[model samples]
Target: MRSLVQILAAVKELRWYYWGIIICSLLTAATSLLTPFIIKEATDEVVASLQGRGGGISVVLWLAVALLIADLSNTIISNVGGYLGDVMAARLRTRLSQRYFHKLLTLPQRYYDTALTGTVISRLNRSITETTQFMQSASNNFFPMMLTLVASLAITAWYSPWISVMLLVVFPTYMWLTTLTSKRWQKLEAKKNSHVDIAGGRFAEVIGQIRVVKSFVQEKRELASFSDHYDATIGLTRSQSRYWHSMDAARRGAMNLIFFGIHALIFVRTVQGAFTVGVMVLLIQLVNLAKQPAMMMSYLVDTAQRAIAGSRDYFEVMAEEQERDELADPVVGGRRELAPDEPMIEFRDATFGYEDGVDVVHDVSFAIRQGERVAFVGESGGGKTTLVSLLLGLYQLRSGQVRVAGHSIDQTPAELLRGSVGVVFQDASLFSGSIRENISYAHPGASDAEIEQAAREANAHDFIMGFEQGYDTLIGERGLKLSGGQKQRIAVARAMLKDAPILVLDEATSALDSKSERLVQQGLDRLMKGRTSVIIAHRLSTIASVDRIVTLKDGQVDEIGTPEELARSGGIYAELLALQSGSKQDRKKLKNFDITA
Candidate 1:
């Protein structure tokens, strides 16, 4: 019921169109009712003329003409009303689709952390399609069906109250039976939807990582798993269908029996002279008209239930809390300038975690001066990436504050804060597009010359120029067509084009081959110049040139000093370095610490 109200409220802005449909339906109902009365008059006129007491065939001819006109008018009004309903349905679809997409955009990153991309997309498609179709069906058919039923009942009651009462029983009984099964049907549908969503999510994941699946020889297993979900849906559908049709059959049988009595009542009344033959014909036609809505009751209820289910799912996502935009200040034009003495990035006693009471980074305090290159080295899952995420304002700290350019992160707009930082992750994460689009992503308005200049600085221009289309060359999904080195270089060029005041190199060259690493590192070097750079790398050699290195251990700041100072202090940094040294002496030294080389 709540979902139905929400669906109605969603399309309230187009009430004028709805009103037009209502008017057309009313006219159609009135015109349709005229047909039975006209037929009765024509029958009576023919009978009177045949009995030699009529005003001849002229009256019947005129009634025939009137019937034709009513039929034509009914057709036109119904068509016009259908067209209006179609337009309204389409508009509702557009309105709801745009709102859903906008909500997806405004949602926080944390929402995506546990959301499946395929499931999210599936919800949008299924919910909107079902809702729109139901709306269209209701507008085009439901109102007319209802109006015809009501008018038929009133006319039938005027002739004989018993027939009208019997017709009324048909509808309420059918509806009650439908209402009994609707809950169970909807539950089954929801369960089926779960299976389908999971399958869809897995389908997308498999397609996205087809190479992994193939390489692992799990193609058969994946195919079987995918088929299993559909099989489960089929099973649920069988039960759902059986339950619905069984109840529908029972409703229909009861309706048929009542209608049988209605037909008998009309016939017997005419035979007993209580009703004229013409009146009997009119009542029979009215009964047939009323039967239309009664028979259609089940279908309408089915559509309503599907729509309610879909709307409930759609509104569930919309009801999710969106990121608060009012709390952060807006960015003006370009990046804000920072004073030379100001720390470009600051984290004071920062603590954070993905889950409550499980802090990933604890009591971590640090400051990076403008243009200073700092590196963070730690074991896997030691909160290295989490810190960078916090710094970039991707996640809020638990108890402490992080500031960028003297503005607290919590008070700064995410876009404004992120606009001041350029990051090159381990994965290039490039979309499928032309080289020009990928390179100009960070600065879409960049000129050809500016794009080339950034690419050249990243050592990508030469390789890109070698292609037939140069910057126009198409790179497939995630830059699968390019070598690891080429992709990283493009990412570096992107960061370079951004020209933000701060840079973060998160294992930027970790995945590249030695030769590719050299090329990408050259680009990283030029990109990092004059920026407050935060580096996270497992390779100690990569950070050898950093001004300072902060070592993290078990979610705490284990050491913070110059690279040389931390190396000699024999903490997590020295242990990591010794492990990477690959010498017998370094391997023997690992025994002194709680680590293995």
Candidate 2:
């Protein structure tokens, strides 16, 4: 959660695995150094035997046995360490990914509104996979390599100080160069990832709305745009690959030259009789062992840098302010109490907007008593939906007050109102689930019988049974597999299952054809009875039976009366009704009615 090493090290459950890594690394290094010593011993033994020295064969036999044990144990321990590293990496991935997912769920609506789904998904995927790999790389590769280097260097220094001096001088320079190259690569790699994210977002956006694309005949245009993004991403990736290859080649070239020089020096020393051939062989082996870790350092450094960058992006999302869960906290010195018998719903001078100082629902004041069927009719953007959103506590008030069930909304717990008010939105949003599942969504533990009854009441039972799978039929994404009316009926079934004491329907049946609308309206009428209902509709006939109609214009209430009274008033409502009443031919003669205009 912090720096790469700190984050990995902080996993308490992996503490034992980390200890195993350290112990196994040390053991592996010890065994690795022992093999080269045994080689030196065998070489010495063969030289002594050729010179007719005593116990030469037995000495070689002992060294061979030691060599076998060292190499086998080293292999076994390294595998064990690698296994432990994988386990730790998997745990880290699971825990952090879960945390990120939960954080995503907690984020406010504004984040979802602005962030592209593809970009968010890409970041989430990389953050978990890359970060864990970076940690595992450090633990299994980087740390073990460092241990090997230390063990090999110690042996080399003990045998030959002159050789140790050369290693000290060349190795640090090599490491510094690798680090510098890795830093540059990390930056370029991050840039490449950005381009990839942009391309992914573009791709997802176009594909998700494929229907609209074909309808508008913009497939060719969308393809051109996506191609442009993808090409840019490919260009950035190619540049990054070029830099990586160049750095790798340069590192190898430098390493080969340095090692060759060291070998040449060792050969000269041996020829001058300064050291035996055995000593020369051991130094060479040690140098090679040390070089292995040094070479791995570059790749590990690159991974660490990339992980840091990815984690930063990941944590940045996690740091966003989450939606408030307080339900309601009353304002200081404001109304702290309410009458138990007050109207079921009241909005007193309530003003709010998505932005400050620009009210969408301006100074709106109204009240609906228990069991009242009140309808709100307004043109688009006249704040009909916004008002409903306010009542549902989807928004905070900029001014005034909203009271529900005899309690000030700011003082009442949100769950209290949420549990009491059932809403069927215009879109009838449904998940990719079975019909029974969708109906039970409002009440997850609802019995099958209860679900069936709700579906029957919503008039969705007949159509639902017509499917081969009946209630178990899989609805495609957003229930696209179902017809518009089917989805609406299922939505109503969901609301009916909730059996809330209050209901709000925002153009719930607006999208259905005449026959579908009639069927859905019948269910809606049953749902609205014996409850405090708020209906927002554009089709005047659908709401003609409501007890009262509140008309809005330019963010204020323009009229409030029974449908009969409003029709007789010759106001905006009367004009709208007359316009709809005209014959199809006559309607074409009149201009379209726009209340806002």
Candidate 3:
């Protein structure tokens, strides 16, 4: 119940509809109570005086007609209220979903470091679906049941105090059974969702690495793993069903017992004419009417418990405090005006990490002026990648200052920073879209002419033209249809399209062959003409053309100088060059060098 309140608070924007849903359900409960009087009148007064009062039949018929109209009206209004509840749920679901996506995109890179890709995906999908179900169920049923239960109890006590006491006693017993059992149901619901999430993760992993699985001939093993998860989810679901059904059975049996007990007490009261015949019949009809609200209340319990349980988990992700975007002063408008002809980037004694307890990049500082290409080369566990991530605003600096385009990185707006810095990650990240869309991603509204120009600058235009549909050709998932170098070139073209003043080249050309590498080298040299470029490279052979090389070893600057100058020092960089360049440099070794270059 506490969790349900929290989830409902998220959709508080549609308060009127929420109230409307409750009110309509109360109306249904009210109308149901009135029908009992009509039944009693027909049974006692009209039948007893069939030939005595000429108006007796007319009175009974009119009341019957009134009851019919009331029931019909109640049904219509309830359906309308249900429809409104659905609409409200849909609207909130959409808003929450969009927010969830932007949250992922803007979240610190460290969040992804420990978060599994499939776990994130499951929350984005199943968690949101359950949340929407909660909103619908709560508005359509939960609140209404509470209203029905209260209204019925009040009216019941007003009509026949003794019999109403019976309902009061039985109702609580039924409620206690349902609620006590719901605790176990809630646990199973969460476990059920967890199992599904694991299944989804394994499915994504298997599909992604199908080729590897095939080569290893482990298809049967993967299928068995998936089947086990499915069965676990199914088992939990069955248990959840039985838990609720037991409550339903107990509730129905209790209602029947209450009805018999009330009627027997009423017959005894009517013996001395203390209660008229019509009144006795009315009590009987009312006795059944009394259960309407109780039954609705029970249904509401079932729906609300399930919805709220699922919603609690969903809100866990949605309610995560977002990273603060507080800036001293936020900049606005296009990034064009702030572009520097000979831009300079400076990191002044910066210290930062992905989490609070441990720092990854310690008191580090560097400066790069326009047209000066600098590379950060290091072993795998060093801080080279961390440095690049910090520069890209994927992680905030814990201390010191990072300035881009002569302005403080902290003072710069995140949107503005995103527009200004162009990066190509080592994995050659690409989405499912046309080749043209992939290039023009940073600036979505870029024209075809701008896109073609950028592609040509990245030396990808010629190859793109060779595709059957040219720029319109669709790339498969992760650009799997394209070769490694092809994907890298497309990613390069995307950065080129951004046309930012500063570029972070994190091994952007590492996957290319000698000829393709040479072609891209000329394009990159031209593109870096007046921009501050920071490169994270592993191939010592490739840094010869760069203006300067800064080697990272064990999280500190091992050597900082030109490739030739650093080689003369006989440090980590020199040793790496010696190991990489042999009489026959392993092509595979060179491939990894290119990958991390």
Candidate 4:
């Protein structure tokens, strides 16, 4: 097992509290050592005065003073340790959030693409809480207890060397035995942590896709599956409790056996008459005090080991390599603009594969000339979005290359590429803020005039102004309060605000009503007037004026040309147009259904 040292090193920001928590615990240990000495003095002094030496009052009074001092020491030390413990706990929780939250955002899209949102949520919640709790549990009672235990054993030896030797052997043996017994539980906690994440993620996904789940009528099955996992989690928790109880039961038995051993040693020493009755009483008190520390030391070790286990989980996450921004010496980034005289977009025999190794896209070649509108038309299983993703440099190609403005995306800085392009995705995300805030999300400092103009271009300004609060009204999550067309237009307004040199529209107008769609399409037409635009259009008429159409089938480019040229060529593009032109709900509608499959 790796030590918790590596995990502890992660809190660069809270180093002072980490050390403070430990040092204060040691102070408590020092206060505790006074306990046995106080008892010993009080016992012997009273015994001597009662027997012969009758300075009884003063001697007894002196013993009382020593005890009072011990109590004061304990109260002060314990409180200080407690304060430090709270400090450590508070800082640790803040640090966990800082580390994990930033890491969550930086992780590649593919990581989330395969994970369950619930599982990530559970980890974020439970894992972070467990880690923070470890800070308190390891420091507060646990630390002070361990120090007191070892110190008490040493003090016992100073009083009676032989008795101290016996205690020393017993403590280690008891710990070894208990540790061996509880092995099952440590492994169980780790396994439970992993399973919970998977289960949580599954539940989150099921809930997020509730509409689909209901469409498929899998509610009963989903609930049953979750119930089984919930039961398993409960079973594991009980098993862990049982193991600890059994270990504790055995430890109590060991404590009793040690006391018996002490009594037997004292009986042999009684013949000397060197130690008084009072000394015997004092020995009993010292031994009991010593026993508690030993028991507590074992508990401290348990707390530490458990923390180490929990820390192991936190370390696992921090250990996964982060995707660092590789932009080096060249301060300039990949700026999106038209080349002197060439295509604005180019894929030179590109190849890319996801973590699944399914080869979602393979060797492909295509180009979109400057000031041209290019539509990627495809049937089901075709890589329309994937192709755009490559052009955007989101997923670096495994082989070949992609270039924008005749500059290689692989070689260009990500910041520059991001700054150059404006995109309106199929699932446009809206913030839970005012309409003004949501539209200006990409460019927070956009002027009011620029924002209003962008809204007008998106054909959303009129509806937005009709609201009582105008642009200040909140949209809520995913814009649920707004109509579908409003949300889509809001998204279009956001993209328009960016005013990037390159524009991307993936089913941008799919959610809008016919009238709104026409208005927004006109806004889009103006946005695309001179810029290089890549569009994924389901409507046949929308792409009629585009410079070229690239037809895709099963991840391969089947044809590329103007609508007239492709129609004349009698290729896949022509067939798709023929179907789309027949009815509003024609073969084109069937093609849209296949995209998700």
> How many angstroms is residue 570 displaced in model 2 relative to the true structure, after the best TM-score fit?
5.2
Clashes per candidate (backbone, < 3 Å): 0, 0, 1, 2
Candidate number of the best TM-score: 1
Error of 2 at 425 (Å): 2.1
Which candidate should be chosen as best, given lDDT against the real structure? 1
**Candidate 1 local accuracy as lDDT?**
0.87
Q: List the residue pairs that clash in candidate 4.
A: 119-200, 119-201
Residue 96's lDDT in candidate 3: 72
Clashing residue pairs found in predicted model 2: none
Candidate 1, 283-326: lDDT as tens digits: 88888888887787788888888888899999999999987674
Q: Rank the models by TM-score, top first.
A: 1, 4, 3, 2
lDDT of 2 by residue, 1-597 (tens): 266665665467778988998998888888888888889878877887898983676788888888999989999998898888888888888888888898887665557767888888888888778899987887777788788887777778887777777776666777677676766776777787787677777778877778899999999998887688778868877887788778777776787787777888889989999878788788888998887876775677667767887887777777788756655554333323335568888999998877445888888988998899998876667888788878877677889999886677676655666777899987889999799899998799999999999999999999999999999999988898999999999999999999887899988987789999988998998898898899877777778899998988778888989999999998767867877888887555333322221
| Candidate 2 TM-score versus the reference | 0.86
**lDDT (C-alpha) at residue 129 in model 4:** 75
In candidate 2, stretches whose alpha carbon ends up further than 4 angstroms from where it belongs are 1-3, 6-16, 54-59, 161-175, 178-187, 247-252, 272-275, 325-339, 355-357, 392-403, 406-420, 564-572, 582-597
List RMSD in Å for every model shown: 3.1, 4.3, 3.5, 3.4
Q: After the best TM-score superposition of candidate 1, give how far the Cα of residue 274 lies from its true spot, in angstroms.
A: 3.2
Model 3, TM vs. native: 0.87
TM-score of each: 0.92, 0.86, 0.87, 0.87
TM-score of 4: 0.87
